[model samples]
Target: MTSIISAVPACPQAPQAPQAPEVPQALLAVEGAGLTVPVVGGGVVEYANLDYAASAPCLSDVAEHVARVLPYSASVHRGAGFASQVCTSLYEGARRDVARFVGARDGDLVVFTRNTTDAVNLLARALPATAGGVVLVDLEHHANLLPWRGGGRRGTGDVRCVATQPTLEATLDALAAELRAAPVALLAVTGASNVTGETPPLARLARMAHDAGARFFVDAAQLAPHRPVDMAALGIDYLAFSGHKLYAPFGAGVLVGPADWLDSAAPYLAGGGAVREVSTTGVDWATGPARHEAGTPNLAGATAIAAACRVLTALPPGAWERHETVLRDRLLRGLGALDDVVIHRIWPDGGEPVGVVTFSLRRHDPALVSAFLSAEHGIGVRAGRFCAHPLLARLGAPGGALRASVGVGTTVAHIDRLLDALATYLRVGPGWGYAHRDGQWQPTPDDRRPPAWVEQYA
Candidate 1:
């Protein structure tokens, strides 16, 4: 019995697992978190999206809200089904939400359009026939300038372009003088410069416009996302903004103002929803938002935008301002450290700017730098006139410049990565050859594959 017995070998104990590195909270969580991009050197890295000025990444909350509502989505206004009723309620509710967010007055009307450009163009069409002149500055975006210049068949009065002064106060004074000299019906200005991120004194400008018997209109596309806009409190007669620029990249925009001009003018579009009755001989138009929101509306877009406004408004006061200020200061300090980097700014006294910084390298092409950032590092940025050609010409960079804009989802680490990449590019030029074509820089003999999602969609 002793000979038959055998002892079994003892099994080794399992090794304890190593600790995982702590994951830091984002400066602001947004959709596309931890997205990876393929670099030109055959490796994938986390994508750093810094092009918020052009189009901000959708907020996570907004995306979730849309997803939740998609199941119950239906045509808004004219349906008798339960889904239709829900959709109608949601659409109307969205209008109310946006109005509350901007502090719209009692008689103000909110009309949703495709984008800021479309919203401004709609307003242009609605300009009063009695308006003798339309005054604007050279620093305005094409959306703000071109609409007044060509206001469809209504003709947007005599267009007057005012020159921007070195100081904000001087610019306001010049604008006031022009307003006083001419019978200007409207004084259109950007709440914040899309090119320089410099915010003009809105209250002062509003007063000047009113004093000269002109209605003050603000293109708040750049200002609304960074700062809260109170249309009633600020004495703004009309305001326009795009949802794409406000962390809701749905194709929708808002033009909120008094209803008199909009209602008096012809419907912006001749279609089903715009018309209350249409016969072979003549047509009677529907009133309120339906007059301009022709055909079936983008219910999802409006809802998503409303969700974004709600999320932003719910945040603790000054939370976003504090976060962006810190990031802006860090970005400016980093850029200032680089000797060859020249930042384009409007104010010489270093006035407070939003989270947008435009700059140009001493010896490098802006397009090439932007391309190199994407190819070498996974950083995304915008490099061009930024839709402000006149402003760029005045700033002495007609060729163009690089813009690294920040918003929700942008982090200090992203800014550091961009600055470090710029420094590296300055120290040692790009490893790959690039050629300028069609006003853009592209890598020669490009061999990088598209991301998996793009490939699947394609």
Candidate 2:
């Protein structure tokens, strides 16, 4: 059998370098890049944050951007003060920045929400009554799945979960078959699996959905931060992503899409700003994005997202992709060399994955391994079903699995440290005892304390 290492290309084409006006230095520096963590032996090691799939640390530039706007923070939409006017302009300008960043089509509306879940729920509420059904695959995050299943106004559309095939082409074909067989009004799919980081054939799936008279939606919580997304170019009717996962941890998310369904549907939240007029007997509703974005929005969150988007756009064309690929390959090859390691994947041929890698050792509990890595090796990773229980069950790890995800801040040393920690655990058992508590494996007699700054702030 050919080794996976041999199958990888020796020399892939380098990504195009950025032209003049390089990325901001602040954007390049991630907060908590050199954080220190205490090990079990009373020694501290530099923390390796490899759980980027969940939530990434804030980018320095995003933080700076927020600081710059903090002084002028005021009520948006309807205020008489000068601060309010500036704040409103900044908020609206952020909407424009995000629209352009995602390549939104002309007239497309961008609605600000709390997070991707909120954005998807908003879309669910906006589903028109004429829509027939919603089609998605089993390999979706809960955010993408539950909204279509139990959410939506009128609760009219029937939900169908298509099984993912062993190959990307086969999975797309199955989705096409389902779309052809039913009157699918919407097809919601993940841009990339948060668990395995497997990227589906998004463009093909969008084409298929549109050809079958269904609108396509992408849960880009994972994809948007890793790669560029063009709504018009990919034929995506809608897209939802969170700033927390995009190096802007400001509790903001976006839903960028067409206006017809949203404008026709009732406002997501009824409040002072979302209404046109109100009387004792009746009320008139506002149209456009204002119809949905009801109260005072997260002005800072929106600004942070826009700032991060600008930083990403300024980066060399393929620099992020190339950098991540090298790290991913290194991690995969290192894990492959371990005889006791087992890498879990969806496709049989081991299709290309993003920065996330999920696997388990032959004789170790996933949670225990995760705890050991953190407590002894100062490595942070996610260990659980990763919110995609169906996919994990299908992958034969019904209990759970461990996932190590990378991002712009991840370094080759971090990946190596994780691999070395796992190898050490396999060769020699954990140095400390671990027990499952509150559904998570925690070290016994844990004595970890907050950093000095945290204590002072608290």
Candidate 3:
């Protein structure tokens, strides 16, 4: 743990910031690996969770880390006793571990927040006034898009969004055109797409942004879990990500970037830890991460995030890519062979993306498909626009899509299970009928009962 704190790389200078799948006994084990859930026909099936893009199950290692540290948890930065001191040490150390995980520059600031939304909003508030504006793309999540959309509390005239093109090269050209048209403060992009699982060339984007006199930022919520991020290597100026997406449960996130603008900006919150002096007449605010994080922090969340970073970083080189590739390929092939299935993609001339695939069955509503899968087959997948309304509009899927993402634990058997379920559903349809209620689809006259623990608790 101490070693992780010291492993973050220091860069000369610069800025910027910031998937799915299934099956089998996963190549990698996660929490709830052997858990069973009640399904249709009064029987149980191992939950076929194919929704890593939304929120992943806790990693077994991360759970163990959480349990190990809970006893030492206490008031952070305020306590003087051994537990408090230890807590404080761990709390502060998380920033370093996270920084190391993302290969953040030496002098970069890692500000902890509730999640990616909070992280993005923090950067939105801290951007230097002199900096022109932020350039966004069509394929951004709401967490990235809404923060800078401008108007009301969000402010306006500081954002410009580009439309994606047919190919990645064309998309880059489109992005470049947008940057050239104006001297923007930053070129913001997602490191890996959540909807289509596309990974734009970060190095090229960084070069494009710098050439246009704009700093580059990446929302790595999707990319970080599948690939490594080196701000220096990628020429990124800022980054943001969520621990929930990284398989840590207590809801932690990070915004890593330069100190210049953040120091110049006002504190994100007005509270105890964010000040050096507080008199009635005037108050001197604190700087660094404390400037933005101004209250009792989530010690467990931060620690869990740090522990997850350690676990991911320790995996053998290319381990994640190898695991997800096999499962993703099997899924893509199976889905492709299915009739009347439209696989949505932003870039036609593409690359091997992260393990996420979104598609729509020709005559099936995505909600019904998801509900049917869950109720009848014990499979879990995301069914929605995925919060990138613009991108969904571009793809002509305003209604929504069904996304299946994989993790290291996902296996060939799991992929086959989902494929088989989808095939069976498309061919024969559900034997039982479903109804829409509470804004979702579910089996009518459902008889499945909750587990004993849930029933007792409820």
Measured by lDDT, the strongest candidate is: 2
Considering lDDT, which of the candidate structures 1 and 2 is the better prediction for this target? 2
Query: Which regions of candidate 1 deviate over 4 angstroms?
Result: 1-27, 151-156, 349-351
TM-score of each: 0.93, 0.92, 0.93
- Quality of model 2 by C-alpha lDDT: 0.84
Find the number of clashing residue pairs for candidate 1.
0
**For residues 1-458, what per-residue lDDT tens digits would candidate 1 score against the true structure?**
11110111222322222222322235566998789887875888899998999999889999999998899888798999999999999999999999999989997998999999999999889888887688899999999999887738364468899897887667777888899887878889998888878888787788988988888899999998888889889899999999999998889999999998899888998898998788999998988888999989999889988998999998888877777777777777778777577899876753467888899987567888888899879899999899999999888889899999888687777887888888767766677766666756777646688867888989
Off by over 4 Å in 2: 1-27, 349-352, 452-458
Cα RMSD of all models vs. native, in order, equals 12.6, 7.4, 10.8
Instruction: Name the candidate, 2 or 3, with the larger lDDT value.
Output: 2
Candidate 3 lDDT, 337-422, residue by residue in tens: 77667999998876669988999987568988888889888889999999888898889889998999998777676677788877
Model 3 regions lying over 4 Å from their true place: 1-25, 151-157
Residues forming the 10-long window of minimal summed lDDT in candidate 2 = 1-10
* lDDT by candidate, in order shown: 0.83, 0.84, 0.83
Error of 1 at 276 (Å): 2.1
- lDDT of predicted model 3: 0.83
The weakest ten consecutive residues by lDDT in model 3 span 1-10
